[model samples]
Target chain A: MATKKFMFLNRKAPYGTVYALESLEVVLIGAAFEQDVSLAFIGDGVYQIAKNQNTDGIGMKNFSPTYKALGDYEVTKLYVEKESLEARGLTLDDLMDLTWEDEDDDYAEKPSIRLVSAAELAAVFDEQDVVLSF
Target chain B: MKYSIMVNEGPYTHQASDTALHFCKAALEAGHEIFRVFFYHDGVNNGTRFTVPPQDDRNIQQEWSKLASAHDIDLVVCIAAAQRRGIMDADEAKRQGIDGNNIAPGFRISGLGQLIEGGIIADRQLVFGD
Candidate 1:
């Protein structure tokens, strides 16, 4: 089968509901399917990958670490909307430093998180075969 | 073109279901093939036959059932989401010791794999949600 471009759009915050977690679950599964998968963190969805997400008091499982595992799943394209991060008074440094190894370059590490403008991301959406939002 | 639709919200509570229904109608009218309509999250409520809207209002559940029957479209309600929201098929209801199943005609309870399969097979996969 031809590989399709699949984008998982996340617009909700973590711990509020099951959207973020379930969205991640789908991404992990989509990885096994070996499609050209990309994850977009828009709006409060950026909070999902924010650093130091301590859920001890909230009594919820902290699945933030799973985002770091995206590299292993070959889901390397993680787009963080520039406007969304700025609107929330956050910088790229606040989020996890996710990376993937480039086998073509002798296993050289490459940054997976791409800080993109809204317009640029809109263009990216146009190039996708499937946009699964959560 | 083959199109797949995913509804993430329930009827009457959100406009997602309504938008998806209208979109499906438009797609069908345009001579497009509807590969599947996968209801997830609260969208599973759209497959339940127990929804009784006021006579003066639109019956969303009935509308979907009629559309599915007329077009011979596959209306799949995600089994995991349906189970979480108390929407079950006859077999599931019996297995879980529930009183009865509320799955509507022309609708079936299935897994998330159906959603993934739809995305793979269809030319487009449109998601309607909050």
Candidate 2:
């Protein structure tokens, strides 16, 4: 099949629901098909990649580390809405440093997180052929 | 145009499944082709054969089965999600060394790849969920 622009819209928080983790599973499996895959974090979804997430007391497996491996699968584009982060009293420093290696550029690591405004994210969403929400 | 559907919630609890069913019926009635209906998360429960709703109420699983039978639609349940929720077919149940299977007709357990493919193969894909 021909590759299409696929975006997974994450609008929910982490562990309280299964959407965050299951959304990641679809992204990983979708990567093997080599589509133009991107992930957008909006609303409470921005909390999914919050750094230093310790789930020991919650008794749930911490899957935040899986976001780091997304780059390896060539699922590079990750857009986070700036307004959402600011609304939740968070800054870029609060998120994990997710980056991708540019194989052609001497394997230099480049940031994958593109913090955008609501308007900018709307344009991104308009370009997708498919968008699945979690 | 060809379309694909993703259902993220199960029967009765959330309206996602019912909404998807109505949309599918409407789409088919309008002469559009439905490439597939991929059920995931709690939506896998829609494919269980053991669900027995009140007779007066709509039988969610049976409705999907009848739709699939009439339209030849592909109803796919994610295997990983099904295993987590115990929605199994005979093959899956036997493979897992279990005694019984509860998958409804017109549905088959597959992989997340099928979900991705549904999006890729169809002209448009719709997701019904929270």
Candidate 3:
């Protein structure tokens, strides 16, 4: 089958619900297929990748570190809605640094998180062949 | 068109499973091909065979099982999600050092990759959850 753009939409707060974690599981598993995979953090989903996540109090595994490993899986393109972040009182600085290595460009590291406005994200959504929401 | 359906919530607690079943029935009746129905998150709960719902209400898991058998549909429960939710098959049960399995007939535990594969193969992919 041809490579289709599978964009996963994360719209919930991490740890509060299992959507963010389960969606990441899909993204990690999707890497082996080598398809064009991308993830969007909209609304409260922006907190999913917020740095300094400590789950010691919650008794749940802190899966926040997994987001960093997504780069190794070749599953880049983490889009954070600018409006969503601001609405949540967060900024790009609040998120973890997620980057992928470019093997052809002397293995240069490039940022994977793209901060897009809701308007710009609409275009991104239109380009997706499949949009899986969580 | 070949279609893939995804259910992201459990039965009774949410309407996603019901909506997905309805969509599948309607799609099949309209003569569209259902490539697969993927259960993820709480949706994996739809594959458990241990449910004992009130007699009057519908048995969502059994309904999915019956629909899959009659239509040769593939019902896949995401293994990771299933494992997390204690929805195990015989193999998984044994692997996890458990005594028995609760997977409904016509359903199998598989990787999330199956969901992505369906997206690639299906002409249309419908998601039935928040």
Q: What stretches of model 3 exceed 4 Å from their correct place?
A: none
lDDT: worst 10-residue window of model 2 chain B: B115-124
* Docking model 2 quality class: high
Candidate 2 has an lDDT of 0.96
Ranking by TM-score: 2, 3, 1
For this target, which candidate reaches the highest DockQ against the unseen true structure? 2
- In candidate 1, the residue pairs with backbone N, CA or C atoms under 3 Å apart (3 or more residues apart, or in different chains) clash, namely none
The better-scoring model by DockQ among 1 and 3 is: 3
RMSD of each: 2.1, 0.6, 1.3
TM-score of 1: 0.90
Better of 1 and 2 by lDDT: 2
Q: List, for all models, the DockQ compared with the true complex.
A: 0.51, 0.89, 0.83
Model 3 Cα lDDT, one tens digit per residue, B1-130: 8999999999999998998999999999999999999999899999999999999999999999999999999999999889989999999999999999999999999988899999999999999986
Candidate 2 per-residue lDDT over residues A1-134, each given as its tens digit? 79999999999999899999999999998899999999999999999999999999999999999999999999889999999999999999999999999999999999999999999999999999999899
Check candidate 3 and list the clashing pairs: none
Docking class of 3: high
Report the TM-score measured on chain A for model 2.
0.98
TM-scores of all candidate predictions against the true structure: 0.90, 0.99, 0.95
- Please give the distance, in angstroms, between residue A11's alpha carbon in candidate 1 and its true position after superposition: 1.4
Ranked candidates, highest lDDT first: 2, 1, 3
